[model samples]
Target: MNLVLRASILLLVLAGAPATAFAQDASDPIGNILDQVGQPAPATPTPPLPVPAPRAPPPAVARPTPAPPVAAPYPYGPRPQIAAPYAPSSSTYAPPPPNLSPSLAEPVFVDEYDRTPDRPMNSAEQGYENRMRSSFAAAQGMQGPLDGAWTLRSDAGQAVYTLLLVDKNNGRLEGAWRDPRRPGSRDSSGFLAAIQKIGTQLTASFYPSPGAGAVTLTLTPLGNGEWTGELTEGGARLGVVMSRN
Candidate 1:
């Protein structure tokens, strides 16, 4: 009988417990255990991640170097040298020879009468011989009164000129007219031409110089070694008188 009574008490005590205790045991048993032991609950452990393989480094690159630059040449070249001039020697100089002709070396003298004696005389020699003959004839009184030097005077009695009358061997006549008073006078000689005598009336042409025209004179004999004449030149006439000089 006592055992039956204890079983009945046990059934009654279970029925008296709360419904939340059963829920706690089913949802969190450790928490219920920790509640009974009066301690906190422990956290759960996390899992480790797997590691990846490392990649290779990128490839290295290479670069080339450039060549050195070239140099240039000059624009012009060097200049040339000059040469000197040439000169002659003293041995090449020489002088000319001396002159040897006879005319140059010695002088020649010729006589005035050395030419042919038989040849006809020139006018100069004939004139000189005529003067000599006239002088000789006057000394012998063989010539007329007109055959000598005469002094000619103008109308005013001033002596103007001198006149000479000569007779040649050929019966021709020649004369000279001289102006003695002129300064620097050189042998004022002239020649008579075309003389004509008609009974002491004489007419002749006189030339004062070579290549000059003739002057005409007409004369009449006056006694005692005198004569009167008219001298004409270029159609101009003048009375003149003459006397023996």
Candidate 2:
């Protein structure tokens, strides 16, 4: 009975022991080991804090305006005038022959007689008339060897039945092609357009009324009252020689 009583007392003492005593007993061993190495006891582990979300990048900023490019100075100077397609020949067309005087080339104009009472001319009207006469005289004075009719023949010595007339006094040209074999058949005849003269060269443009395209002729004087030239039309080229008739 005494032994059972003693055992019951020991159980009661153990059951009544403070929790601090058990913790101290359990930590003593590790604490002693750390003390022996001169180190601090390890702290209890804590869960890692949630990582902070990355902050959004600041709004993009616009780039500054770049400076304008500077142009380089011209090495020589300002650009020069565009050159002519071809240099003008130094030789000029000769004056009209002595036989072809301005008086003989002047056009005659006949005015109808007015039956009404005659009126005195004013100063303005007289001045205009004088200017008109001066201009007419000047134009008539410019006519030269190119004023007469010309005949164009082929290498075979056959007449091409082509006739050309240049009226320098009126700045006009006309050409006609006919079929000599067929008495009254006419192929072409009209005034040439865009007549220009440069040195001894003459260029004339022609547009046939019934034809679909146009043609241009560039004629160069070959002296001796003759001219040689080329006609360009529709990508085709033809050689022509003309002599005064």
RMSD of each: 31.1, 23.2
- In candidate 1, what are the lDDT values of residues 53-157, reduced to their tens digit? 797888887766767654434334334445666655557744323332223332221211233423455577799979998987667486655676777788988
Q: After aligning candidate 1 to the native by TM-score, how far in Å is the CA of 109 from where it should be? A: 30
* TM per prediction: 0.39, 0.35
How many clashes in candidate 1?
0
Per residue, candidate 2 scores C-alpha lDDT tens digits across 1-245 of 99999999998888868676777768688775765795665898999999999999999999999998765556555555677797555585443355533343322311112222324445777899789989966775787556645655444545443445556555555444332333333434555666667777888776644564777777788857777777676778777776655
Q: How many steric overlaps are in each model, in order?
A: 0, 0
lDDT of residue 179 for candidate 1: 60
Q: Residue 234 in candidate 2 has what lDDT?
A: 73
Where is the poorest 10-residue window by lDDT in model 2? 109-118
Local distance difference test values of all predictions, in order: 0.67, 0.61
- Which candidate comes out best when scored by TM-score? 1
**Lowest lDDT 10-residue stretch of candidate 1:** 105-114
